[model samples]
Each structure stands twice: as C-alpha cells, then as structure tokens.
Target: MEVRWDIFLIILGSALVTFLPRVLPLMVLSRMELPDWGIRWLNYVPISVMAALVGQELLLHDGQLAPLFTNLELMAAIPTFLVAIMTRSLLGTVVAGMISIMILRYFL
Candidate 1:
C-alpha cells in the first residue's frame, strides 16, 4: 500500500480547521464565569439557528420566497409546529413532522 503524505496532510489540516473553531471557544470559555443575562441570551442561540434553517427551507423555493398558501412543506409544518409546541418532545416532534410531510406528499 502506498501512503500519500500530501493527501494525509490535507486531511489533517482540514480536520484541525474544522475542529478548532468548535473547541477553541469551549476551551477559552470553560474557566470564565458568564453573567446571568449572558447565559440567558445564549439559551436563545440554538432555537434562533434552528428557526433560521427551518424558515429558509419552508419558505423558500428556487431561492425565491414561496407562496404560503400553495407550499406543501408549509402546510405540513402547521401540524408539525403545533405538535412541537404542545408536546415539547423531540422524538414526537420529529415523528409528527415526518408523518405530516408524508401524508401531504401522498395526498397532494
């Protein structure tokens, strides 16, 4: 077997680049105490990111804003959002979303 040093170095460098941004913050922040407001604000980050992703997927088509009335994914999202809000269960929300999309696709 031949080992390609160039390919190996590229893979190692890519891994370092990918890993440092994620780990460096944790390493630096672990020793520092965050303020209560800072921690509270940080709690919204995950949901904000998730909303951005979901909103983009649901509301856009071909890089343009999709019509809300005619979009099948948007229709499916109605029940999925309700299930997520009501149950607050990740597994149930996922299952509900999957089922909602499946039914909407199958019927319409």
Candidate 2:
C-alpha cells in the first residue's frame, strides 16, 4: 500500500498550528509584569475556571437542562467549597470534592 504523505503533511501542519501559540510565549523576551488589577485578579482566575468547568459538567446531564441541587455535582460542591475555604489549597479542594463525589456515587 502507498503511504499517504498528504494526510501526514496535513497532520504535521495541524500539530504546528496547535503548538505555535503555546510555545510563542515561552520564546519571547524577559519576564513581563501584569498591571496591578491583572495581578490582583490572577489568583482568582483558576478558581473561576474551575467553577465554570465544574458548573458545566454538573448542570449538563444527558445534554439537557437539569435542576441544580438535584444532582451529584451540586451536592459534592458543598463539601468542596467548605474544604477549599478551610484548606485554602486547590489540591485539597479537588481531592475533597472527588472523594465526596465518589462516595456519594458509590452509595446512590
């Protein structure tokens, strides 16, 4: 069978396109300082992103709108929030959340 060089070239091109932006920042000049507001808000970015991801995953079951508190995700979030506030660590929150969710899942 003949090798598909065209497909290989397309895959290689797609890979480079995906990688360029990720590598570009690392290749650029010295450490840059974000503005004061940016610096202040940077810490919240991860939590915000986490919240969005968790929210989407929790609220969207079977590709349809669902009730909030009537789900595993929302139920797990309570313990996760308390753990995060108590521990003040992302890993701790994640672990706590996962454990709670898994235990709940196991039971029901």
Candidate 3:
C-alpha cells in the first residue's frame, strides 16, 4: 500500500487552518481576566449572530422580501421565537425551529 504524501499534506494543512483560528483565541483569552462589562458584551455575541442569521433567512427569498403568510422561514421563525421566549432554552428553541420548518415544508 502506497501512502499519498500530497493528500496527507493537504489534509494536515486543512486541519491546522481549521483548528488554529478557533483555539488560538481561547488560548490567548484564557490567561487574561476580562472585565465584567467585557464579559457581558461577549455573552451577547451568540444571540446577535443567531438573530443575524435568522433575520437573513426570514427576510430574504429569491433576492426579495417575502410576504409573511407565504414565507416559510418567517412562519417557522415566529414559533421558534415564541419557544425561545417561553422555554428560554437554546436547545429547545433550535429543536422547535427545526420541527416547525420541517412541518411547514411538508404541508405547505
């Protein structure tokens, strides 16, 4: 059996590229004591990112804004938003969103 050195190098390089960006921040940040205000702001990052992504999905379709009743993304998002508010659980919100989208796709 012959080992492909070119493929092996590509795979190794890919892993390093993928891993460094994610781990390097943690390695650098873990040693520092962040201020309370900094910590509070950092905590909002996930929710901000989620809102950006969800807003993009719900507001855009075929390079245009979709109407509320005709938009599956908007329809699914409403229930997901409610679930997030009611349960306050990230996992439950995500699950409810997925299930809502799946049902909307199947029936509508």
Candidate 4:
C-alpha cells in the first residue's frame, strides 16, 4: 500500500478549514455573557433564515418569480405553514408538507 502525503495533507487542511469557522465562534463566545437585548435579537435568526430559504424555494422557478396561481409548491406550502403554526410540531409539519406535495404532483 502506498500513502500519498500530498493527498493526506490536503484532506487534513480541508477538514481544519471546515471545522474552525464553526468551532472557533463557540470557543470564543462560551466564556462571554451576552446582554438581554442581544439574546432576544439572536432568537429571530433561525426563523429569519428558515423563512428566507422557504420563501426562495416556494416563490422562485428558473431563477424567476413564480406565478402565485400556478405554483404547486407554493400551494403545498399553504397547508404546511398552517400545520406548523397550529400544531407547532416539527414532525407534523414535515408530514403535512410531504403529503401536500405528493398529492399535488399526483393529481395535477
């Protein structure tokens, strides 16, 4: 068996590059205390990111805005959003979204 040192070094460097950005922040922030307003502001980050992703998927086609009346994914998202809001259950919301898309694709 032959070991390639160049390949090994490249893999190690890639792993370090990928890992540092994620872990360095935690290492630096774990010892510090955030203010009340900062904590409250941070709570919105996940929701904002999720909304951006979902909005892009549901509203865009071929990099252009999709028509509201004819976009099936947008139609499916209606019930999925309602399920997420009403039940607040991740599993239920996922199931609702899957079923909605399946039905739409099968029938239309």
* lDDT (tens digit, per residue) of candidate 2 on 1-108: 887999999999999999998888766623676688866787898989977887788788888867875688778889999999999998999899999999989986
Q: Worst 10-residue stretch by lDDT in candidate 2?
A: 25-34
Cα lDDT tens digits, model 4, 1-108, are 999999999999999999999999899878889899988998999989989998999999999999998899999999999999999999999999999999999998
lDDT against the true structure, each candidate: 0.95, 0.85, 0.93, 0.96
Top-down lDDT ranking: 4, 1, 3, 2
* Runs off by more than 4 Å, candidate 2: 1-3, 24-47
Local lDDT at 96 for model 1: 95
Could you tell which candidate, 2 or 3, scores higher by lDDT? Answer: 3
Error of 3 at 7 (Å): 1.0
| 8-42: candidate 1 lDDT, tens digit per residue | 99999999999999999999889899999989999
Candidate 1 regions with alpha-carbon error over 4 angstroms: none
Q: Pick the candidate with the highest lDDT.
A: 4
TM-score of each model, paired residue for residue: 0.92, 0.68, 0.76, 0.90
Worst lDDT window (10 residues) for model 3?
A: 54-63
Q: How much is the lDDT of residue 32 in candidate 3? A: 96
Q: What are the per-residue Cα lDDT tens digits for candidate 3 across 35-72?
A: 99999999999989978987887899977888887998
